[model samples]
Target: MMTHPSGLILPESRLSDLMREHPHTIPVFLRHHMVCVGCWMSKFDTVADAVWNYGLDMETFLRELNQSAQSIPPQGTD
Candidate 1:
């Protein structure tokens, strides 16, 4: 439960939890070429785990994820 600047997402946050809570972030993961969307390990892996496995820059990944999370409207909202 590492706290990040975005407050909405953290490095230790699980992929399933993040997607369930903020589906908009799904595109961000895909954009980064992460196969976490439907991966079985997503339930157990954290964002940091995915980033490290994919050899991505932590700051850039977190920034994009946070931006997407912040920009998307709540589900069912007009």
Candidate 2:
């Protein structure tokens, strides 16, 4: 899995992985217009980048991302 000290990068997967595992992340994900969080595009996109797309503060959004990510463990990592 792609590791990030700040959990910025996803857990080595597509955006769909987050969507599939963490339902609570939907609002935040959508807020960033990451409606495709369930698509392959998410894999390539970082949480910080997503927030930038939404024109939000990266640090705050990263907090939200870390919160959301907490619910979804990487595949087979649990």
Candidate 3:
């Protein structure tokens, strides 16, 4: 399992917790056609489970997610 910079464990991080911590990730889930954004199961499912259920490439998907998270502008800069 990979670890997010915020210390959340990837693959094992509950989708709800992840989304709450990084709302930016919601778009990624949408782009991937993942309904986890609003699904109740998000509270119980982990990122890895989403990947497996969607048949996504783990390495690539995680890389994209990391990239998206990194793109968030530093606070107070505009």
Candidate 4:
């Protein structure tokens, strides 16, 4: 798992996979609503950029992302 400086813990799984399963994060993308979060490009993108690009609150966005993590089973558990 890769933890971002902003505290976003990226799973070992690819961004495409994460977004594929967590389509609900769509609302977080304020800009480029059509941009897919789980795409390969997003893998290198940081959570800070995501919020800034989407015009979101860093704290709130982090909270939401962490909350999203709770619903997902930890790696190797599935």
Most accurate candidate by TM-score: 1
lDDT by residue (tens digit), candidate 4, 1-78? 344444344433344434544544445553346374545677666565565667867677666656765566434313
**Which digits, one per residue and each the tens of the lDDT, describe model 3 over residues 16-70?**
7777666777799999888999898888888899999999998888877667756
Candidate 1 per-residue C-alpha lDDT over 17-52 given as tens digits, one digit per residue, 9 for 90 to 100: 777767888999888777899898888999889989
Better of 3 and 4 by TM-score: 3
Where model 2 places Cα greater than 4 Å from the true spot, the runs are 5-27, 31-33, 71-78
Which window of 10 residues has the lowest lDDT sum in candidate 4?
A: 11-20
**What is the TM-score of candidate 3?**
0.78
- lDDT of candidate 2 over 1-78, digit per residue (tens): 243545454534334545554556667777766655556577676554565566777667657766776767644434
Clash pairs for candidate 2: 15-37, 16-38
Cα-lDDT of candidate 2? 0.57
The TM-score between candidate 2 and the true structure equals 0.51
Q: Please estimate how well model 3 matches the true structure, expressed as its whole-model Cα lDDT.
A: 0.74
Question: Could you estimate the TM-score for every candidate?
Answer: 0.81, 0.51, 0.78, 0.53
Candidate 4, residue 55: how far the Cα is off, in Å: 1.0
lDDT of each: 0.78, 0.57, 0.74, 0.53
